[model samples]
Each structure stands twice: as structure tokens, then as C-alpha cells.
Target: MVQERLARRRYGSEVGQWSGWASWSACSRSCGGGVRTQTRLCLEKVAKDNGTDSGDQPPSRAETGRRRLRPIQCVGSDKRFHMCNEEDCPPEAGDFRAEQCASFNEKPYKDRLYRWRPHYSTKRPCSLTCGPENASFYVTLRRRVIDGTRCSPDGGTDRADHVCAAGHCKHIGCDGVVGSPRVRDACGVCGGDNSTCHLVSGIFTEPHLREGYQLVLQIPAGACSIRIEEVVPTRNYLALRAGNKEFIVNGAWNIDNSGQYQGAGATFMYRRQTDTQGETLAATGPITEPVDIFLLYRQMNRGIKYEYVIKRNASLSSVLPRLPNDLQSLPPAPPPALPALPQLPARPSVVPRPTGHRNAVPAPGVARPPHTAPRLPATPAGAGQRRGGVLA
Candidate 1:
């Protein structure tokens, strides 16, 4: 149901483009230069559509068209004002210049010198008030026109309404405030001239569905480039539907990147099992549905490219560890601590006493004790050293 609604909205956008062509063509001629032939063709089409004759008047079609599109004017005996087709206004009387005021002729018919006298300058004031003097003039003019009274040469029309007949009107009121018109056109809203409005053929949208994956595409303003990549697992089948084509990921694939693959510097990923699905068994056993992957890229003038990939479900764990050499570096683990050893007690050392020998010789020229054992003489210890030294 969601997909159906998206498709319908896309079609509606296309229809709007066709309906706006007339306005777009007219606007292009008004703004673009050096496209004389194209502009002429566009203008002719607009004229035919609007019920105006193309070949009737001036040297330039644009000028002729402008003249034919006369501004609606309101004229009264006391004042003369211009009204666009959309709004009502009183006529203006204009002001007499200084020269005209100075040259007022008292003698009506016999003044031969009238030829040298300056004529009054009848200058129509701005429709909207700019200041106090202007406000006074506009108010007095509007009142006189409403009352059906004649104004002096120096006085203007009682009221002059400057209505912007353009689709999106910006009416500047007498109080110096600019207000939006009730009617609006697409041109004003989009700020587009003819070419821009016409170039936008249409817009399309599709509901992206991935049972357990959430995807978001980020687009920068004025960036005409975009790219998408999809990764699929090996054991479980994955399928993606984009536009009219369906893609199938045959084995464990790094469609674009993500998951454990992201740890390996991959940007996108897809998991083998649906986390939300958990261990709950479906009526049809383990769902072997193919995982769908979509890739989309767009570039200015180059246009847009969309790609899809599908793969069987094999958990990301199986695929991530098997990534190529470039992604093989895993984070280092901490060293293990040394095991503790059992403590042992210290042992005591024993010393042996020296024995008497050498035929009971006296010790160093001294007589031995009566019952004590005689000590061996030191008789050149070097000689005895030749024999076995210690207990020998």
C-alpha cells in the first residue's frame, strides 16, 4: 500500500510539469537573451494560448505583445488613474509646474504673448505614498474622486490603486507597506524563470523496505553527486527490488560495507539474521528470503545511477573475519598477567671441624695438651698442597 501511494505521488509531479509549460515559456523569453529563435517560438505559443494575435504590430514581438496587453485604466472627469485588470482605483489629475503657475494669463483671448508663456507641467504622482506630502496628496485625491469633485491643477487624483496583476502580486500600499496578493503562481514560489521551471521534468519516490535494516541517504545542497553500495551475507539469500530490476547476492558479499565489515573500513553492512525476529520460529521454518540491497548515485549532467545487490543469509560474523588482507588488522588485546608461585622456607647450613693428622706433629712450635689430639704442623703448606690438600 505504501509503495502504491509513492508511485501515485510521483505521477502527479510529472503531470504538474506539463500543466506549467505555458507560464514557463513566457517567463523564459522575458529573462533569457541570445536565444532569439527559441524565445520567438515560445512567445508565439503563449500568444496563441492566450488569444492574442502574434503578427499584428511592432518590430519586436515582445514590444508588440506588451502594447497589446494594455493596463486597465480608470478615468473620471476630475481625475485619470491606471488600474490593472485585477484592482480598482481612481484617476489622477497631476500637478502644475512652477513655470505654468508663474505664467497664468489673466487676459483670456487677446494675449498674443501667450506663445512665450510656459505651459503647466502635469506630473502624475506615485501611486503609493513615500512621505507626508505624498500621503496628503494621495488622500486628497482619493477623497475628491470619491466625492465627484474637480481638483486643482496642483492636486492629484483622490486615490490611485497600483495593483500588481502579475500572478504573485506585491502590492505596495499608500502607507509604505508591501503586502502579498491573494493570488500566487508557481514562478513566485520557486523563484524560477522559464528555463528552470521547464527543465524540471518530474520527481519520483519509492518506499524502501528492508525487514530489519534502516538506511538513510544524505544529500548536500547543490551537490549533484550521490552513490550507494549494498553488502550481503553468504548463508541466507538476500534480494533487493529497485525500479524494475531485482538483484540477488549469491554469496557472502560486502555489497557496500557496514556491520563488522565497517570495522574493516567498509561503509555499509547487512546482518544475516534479523535481530528483531530473534529465535521465534515462523510457520515456514527458518525464512530463507533473500536480503535486498540498493545502491543509488547521482551526478550533475551525468544523471543518476541506481544499483542493487542480493545475497544469502550468513551471519556477518562469518564474513567480517574473512575480509581481505587490507582489512585484516584487528585491535590489539591486553597482555595476560603472570601466575602467582608458592613461597618456600629457608634451610640452615652445617660446618665440619678440621681433623688432626700428619703423624701427630706439634702445632706451630707449641707443645700439645696431654689428652688433646695433636694438631698438624704447617710444615710448608705449599708441600702438602702438592698432595691432596683438604682431608687427605
Candidate 2:
């Protein structure tokens, strides 16, 4: 009975004996669901003369009548944690765990030096597991990774949604709160409805795609929540190029694994499903540079579906409106005007002759002489019969 009473006295009530929480510790990371901690001490007040303190004894004796605080193991937890630095890490910054693994570059483990890379362990998410390039064997460098390191190697790229804290994985919602139910809306605004942005969607079915790479779409800067998919299975593959004509994905006719790729100051998630025979591209972005999507056609193309969100009041370029799709729809210019023809001589007027008469008619203004009688020769009467009585 006495021992039980003494034990209860040494470890006081959780709230009553504990001190107020100290200021939170520095965040474990600069971005991506970092964690901050606060700690409280379990204390018990005792007369200075008792000498029953839990820590080191004082150099000098204290007054008999005075009291001092002594720390004890409390019945409750001594530390508490909350999420911090929930914003996304920049694309160029790379992955936090990957950086940790790379720190062991040229490290010796099995009688040889090697370049190290992060090897994810689903069973122990918080462990720092590393492997060499192009090698399947891996080793656990540390039992626990630094707080704020991503729990999974491929959780995401744009943000650190899940992270390790105090050797445990913790989920941070889109609202940046731990264990919250909030999520991003269609516009990718946390806890918001779909009213913030407008949807832009279209299908490309050009009926004929050339034998090589062809432009499928040009996603402008300042667009958000972009998605592109090949709706029907085909031998064609998708490609991406920056505004400077630099290829971002599937360049040089090489196939890339489904993963996150950085370009145009944004990160794109590429997914290829062989089982479904479809390929998809997605991003949560307000990209800072324009990117053009291309289709590499080895065979016939069925169709591609694409959609994105853009704010209102954006200017649609009247100039080169058909710039997308390789500008195949522009009208042909008209032929140059023909040179004027040279002048020709005028045709002469024609006059008709009276039927059965060989003589040409006189001009209309000439007047004929008064009527004249017929005359016959007298000596020539035996040659022909005279028609009139004048001469026979």
C-alpha cells in the first residue's frame, strides 16, 4: 500500500504535473509536409531538503523550508507534433529522400564504392533504404529517416502529401492540415468548388496523321489541372516539347517509364497502362511556360482527348489561331491577277445584195433620171421577132 502511494506521488496526474508546452521545434524541412514538435516536462514539487530529485543534485544545499521542481516520467506522452511546411517543393529541388540517399555517394558498404540512390521500402516507409545504380540489391542505411522525408518514393512530385514524422508516416490533406478531410476541387484549389476556373476540353481526330511526329495540342502558360489521354489504343505514342522546341518526354523515339517529369516550371505525371492499352498525362499546375503536345505515329491514329482549366478573361490569339495541330487548316492564297490583254482592230460593216440581181445598188442619197422608153434596131428585125409594134 505504501509503495503504490509513493509511485502515484512520483508520477502525478498527466495534466496537473506537466508543464505548459514549450515553443514548437524548428520545422524538419523547408517544404512538403514537414513536422514541428512541442514538448512538456512532467514535474513534481518537493521540499528542497528531501533530496529525492530525479536529476543531478545541486552543488549547494538549499533552504529547508523552500521547494523545488523535479521531473518525473509522466503517464502521458511528453511530446506532440503538428504538420508544417505543407507547400510543395520546387521541381528542381528534387525529392527529399533522394537527396538523403545521394549523400552516401561513393560510400563503401560491401568492399566496393558505389553511387547510391533511394530504394523505397513499402514495409518500412520511414527507413532510409538505398541501392546502387542498375543494381537490385539494397541496404538500409538508417533505421529512421529525417522527419519530413516522404514516406513513399512516388507519393507525388508537386507536393509532399505524405511524410515521415517521428519514425511514422503522417498524411497531410490538401488543406495542409493533418488528418483533415478536405480535398482539392476541379480547379485544384483546396476545399473550393469548381467555380474558380473554366474547363477547356477537345478531341483530336484529324483522320490523317503523317508518318512522323505531329502537333496535337499546345497548352498555354497559366493553365491549371491539365489532363491528356489517348482514348483509343493505337501504335502511336505521345510526346512533349517546350516552347523552345526542346523535347520533354518520349524524345528521339524513346519510350519513357510512367513517372513525374519536370518542364515549363511544372511537373507532369505520365502514366502508361499496358493492360488497358492507354496512356495518360496529368498535372496540377499553373505552368509558367507553354508546352506543345505531339503524337508520334507509326500507324493510324484513332483519337486523343485533352482538357485543362484556365481563368476567364484570357486572350485567345486571333493571330495564328490554328497554330495548334501543326497549322494544317490555313486557307491557300489566291493566284496573282493576269496581265491585261493588248487591243485589236475593229471589224468592217457588211452590206447585203438584192436576191437574183448581180448589179450593186447605188448609194441611198443618189437620185435616178426620169423614166426612158425602149429602142430597137430596124435592120436586125429578121433575126428575132419584135415584141412591140414600133418596128418589125
Relative to the true structure, candidate 1 reaches a TM of 0.12
Give the C-alpha miss distance for residue 80 in model 1, angstroms: 44
TM-score of each: 0.12, 0.53
Q: What are the Cα lDDT values of the candidates?
A: 0.22, 0.64
Minimal lDDT window, size 10, model 1:
278-287
**Candidate 1 lDDT tens digits, 93-168:** 2222222222323323233222122221124222111112112221111111111111222222232222222211
RMSD of every prediction: 40.2, 32.7
Q: Taking the tens digit of each residue's C-alpha lDDT, what string does model 2 give over 1-392?
A: 45434656774421135688999999988986678888898775443223344456553446322333433444566776677876778879988888888887866787888788888887898999999988989999889899878777566453357777778777766765554567777666777777766666656655354566777767777677888887555556788877777888876666677888888877888876353455788888877777788786654455577777765432333111122423432122332322222332232232464553222222244232111111212323234343221112
Which regions of candidate 2 deviate over 4 angstroms?
A: 1-24, 27-124, 127-143, 156-160, 175-182, 252-257, 271-276, 311-392
Q: Which stretches of candidate 1 lie above 4 Å from their native place?
A: 1-42, 46-392
lDDT of 2: 0.64
